[model samples]
Target: MLGRLFLKLEFKKVDYAELYLWLGSLMKNNCKQRRQFLVMAAGLLAASVVPAWAAGVSGEVKALEGVAWRNDQPLKLGDPIMLGDHLRTGADSKLVVRLGGDVYLLRANGSLQLENKGLVLGSLRLLSGALLAVFAKSNKQIITPTVTAGIRGTGLYVEASEQSTYFCLCYGEVELMPMHQRSQQFRFKANHHKAHTLDAKGGVEKSPLRNHNDDELAILEALAGRKPHALVG
Candidate 1:
């Protein structure tokens, strides 16, 4: 009877040991599952925060020769950018821009200021020199020294000089408005050119001009230190 009691006690101890081991294993598995769940939750939270941080214009900016300044510093290609900003290109430096399916080839010796107020399409103020603007579906405007070209979905070329400003439409129509006198406006058709001659009183000559190769010729003349031939003489 004594031997049987001792054996029964040993068996009870063995069962308790097994139960304790099983409990330990279950606790370890639970802890691992909880850790995995926490990791997955953190990954999802990071993914949700990315798109809200990227609502502005971002693109590559390349300078051919001189420096290109953004926010008063030099700009680099493939760097992220925003609007309502001023950029100054170094002397004899060209700027190449790519943003939202639009490409702008900016000639050397120029400055551009962008104004994007969300509702209104962005506006560009060209301080000087020439720029070839190619637009997508959106309308683009170029505010020159003496004229403003309201471009409708097309490619256009603009050149500025001390005496006047020139606009040559290659693909679409551009409404030219003299800034000095807001009432005087003209529509320049595709394959047509117009010149806004500046006078003492900020007045412009309203004349229809002709220049077939003015777009190509302006680039050449700008490089050669000569004023391009005026189409609307």
Candidate 2:
């Protein structure tokens, strides 16, 4: 019974998660412009619950280079990220967002949605290009075009495109499951192990870890209030 319940809960309609994220921030309170905010965020109450979270504060804007856009606005260095923020980076651009228990590196030509339930990260959807991250022990989900992985205290990298997605769990554990086919789930635990495709049925075989490095993990870990297991003297 317990096993069945777990499996049932694992199957989430992640495609609609983005839609909810886009409209999730409508629920807020104690605003100076309460009437105006409510007008824009009217129907968001059903999507998001009330919580006491720091407004417009998702993470510390550590560094950025080249040009980037946040929700279509020019992304500044010290801008605090709000929930449902759509982040996009252009050529030669780079961005680092340090969140609670996690840090994200968004490489050039990438886009993603920051989705959280009341300041707790629920789903982080990497739309395109490269995204590198190290997560602390927390309930977070990583989503790409073809793959969705449940992450907890994990180090991972993803490069997503319309054709396919490149995924590698650098350290710790991740549950590799397909968005279309949730039955063929694979749980992986290791350092520098790669799972390129979505599933075994006509899916590409696992490849050796490539691209990402341990030092990168160490850097993100430092910002996330932890030390990377790979870092050694």
| Candidate topping TM-score | 2
Q: Write the per-residue lDDT of candidate 2 for residues 52-134, one digit (tens) a residue.
A: 13333557555677888889998876577766788999998877776665778898999989887785778899888889898
- RMSD of each predicted structure: 26.4, 17.5
Cα lDDT, all candidates: 0.53, 0.65
Could you tell me which 10 consecutive residues in candidate 1 have the lowest summed lDDT? 44-53
Candidate 2 residue pairs that clash: none
lDDT of 2 at 162: 67
Where in model 2 is the C-alpha error above 4 Å?
1-56, 199-202
TM-score of every prediction relative to native: 0.58, 0.71
